[model samples]
Target: MSPSPDTSTDTSADDVMEALVRSAFQVMGVMTRISAEHDLSLTQLRVLGILRDRRPRVTELATFLGLDKSTMSGLIDRAERRGLLKRGKNPHDKRVVDVYLTPAGHELEQRLTDEFRRDLAPVVDRLPHHQRVEFTRLFEPLLSPPLVIKPRVTPQR
Candidate 1:
């Protein structure tokens, strides 16, 4: 059965849902263009963006990125070959290599983020001042907790 429509406006719920999807795609388009400007794929940009703040091992990164180990390894390998990042062993173990962004990685990440922000600024600025403030307030909570850039550490078994 179809769900009841929103009472707040004449627009149907489907319209609002469709608008959300379209808005997401619009953001994605901007993201894709920004990623291309830095010569990286969307997934690669995603990985670097996640690594911008802190380092994580391959296993942990895979879980956070929702990628398998082999796929994550390939991304890391390509990035490493491009001099964007490097792998080094965990301080307490000779075999556990952690991934970290290099100076170039940091530079690219920063540029990609800055450009994306610039691209988005106009969109947000087009809204009325109250809507802009409310949007920022609403968006803040979407980035907390489980969305952490660094995964929580667990004791080795």
Candidate 2:
């Protein structure tokens, strides 16, 4: 006979948050394992992801990534050497440098995306319907909202 669900377990907000944090670590572990197949570091993959979305200045990337200028520069240098990214002068401002994804970077991103999906597919497939629904509800927030900067316009004083 199948085991009964443990309804006695706590499902409070704090408990949910703790579970989410633990789940995030599990997801990171999976991502690391899959990403290692490409011989790329997580930071490199993240940088490419950002570049794929928009051309950002080196300093902007550094700020967004929460890395010091030197560290980000080194990462960009390595990725550039791998032919995954290119740094060019911003069209609007020659003094501003912008980073963008090369064709190879795009290909790698696609491959990594596929690998991540493959890694999670089995576990996701095995989940019960209600559990799957709950998982989706919990994870959607992490994937959807990138940042929460305040509104551009301010009220008149």
Candidate 3:
């Protein structure tokens, strides 16, 4: 008769945090290498990923990336020159400028994604199938939009 494997371990919070941070670094390293191969900075690669599905206003995109408006504009300007993205007046609000990915940008983004997946496959494949599914399920919630907490207003008596 054979005994089942032990699946239990005393994992401390600090240990978990360290693991997460290390994992982030590994993923970033892969992304950075892939980005460089395509002659893009990591931020530029991230911009392509962000613009893949949504057309966000300049300010909104800047806020999402934690960049100052001017800095974001410069980044966009460079990308535009490379024909990866474009700026246009929003249809609903003509005064607002929105950013969209060009077809070329989409192609590049797809290639980056494929390359990233390919490069990361070895690390990911180390986990068993069930563990991989569980890992994804646990990580998905972390990718959700941030929760906004509006301040309460006090009425004057």
Candidate 4:
């Protein structure tokens, strides 16, 4: 059976949902253009951004990026060949491969970040002050972790 209509306003929830999806696509296109200015593919930019803060195992990156292991492996291989990344055995587990950023990777990430900030700043500034504040407040929690962190010590350390 079809769901009952919201009957809230002239606009339906489906309209809102569709708008949100389209906004995501528009934002992705904008990001793609900015990334292309630096000659980086979307996936390459994503991998560099992920590696900027910390290293992760190939499997972990695959899971986080919603990519299959084989696809992740190929992406990693290409990034390595470009001198953007280095792969080595995980100190904790020899079987696991960990990815680290090279100096070139750091420079590329910095450039990408600056370009993105410049591209986004004007758009964000155009919003009303209250809306900007509220948006920043709402956005922060989405990026925050809910759990506490525990320190780990490896046996080999």
Residue pairs with clashing backbones, model 4 = none
| Residue 23, candidate 3: C-alpha displacement in angstroms | 0.7
Candidate 2 lDDT (Cα, 0 to 1): 0.82
TM-score of every model versus the real structure: 0.73, 0.72, 0.82, 0.74
Candidate 2 regions off by >4 Å? 1-11, 126-157
Give the CA lDDT, 0 to 100, for residue 53 in model 2.
Answer: 76
Residue pairs with clashing backbones, model 3: none
The numbered model that scores best in lDDT is 3
lDDT for residue 19 in candidate 2, whole number 0-100: 80
Candidate 3 C-alpha lDDT tens digits along 86-138: 99999999999999999999999899889988999999999999999999998
Query: For residues 1-157, could you state the per-residue lDDT of candidate 2 as single tens digits?
Result: 9998665574685687788798779888987886687787887867866777799999888877777789989999999899999999999999999988899988888787787788888867899999989988977887774653333567799
Mind sharing the TM-score for model 3? 0.82
Which of 1 and 2 is ahead in lDDT? 1
> Which candidate should be chosen as best, given TM-score against the real structure?
3
Steric collisions counted per model: 0, 0, 0, 0
- Quantify all predictions' global Cα lDDT against the true fold: 0.85, 0.82, 0.89, 0.82
RMSD of 3: 9.5
RMSD of every candidate to native, in Å, equals 8.2, 10.3, 9.5, 10.4
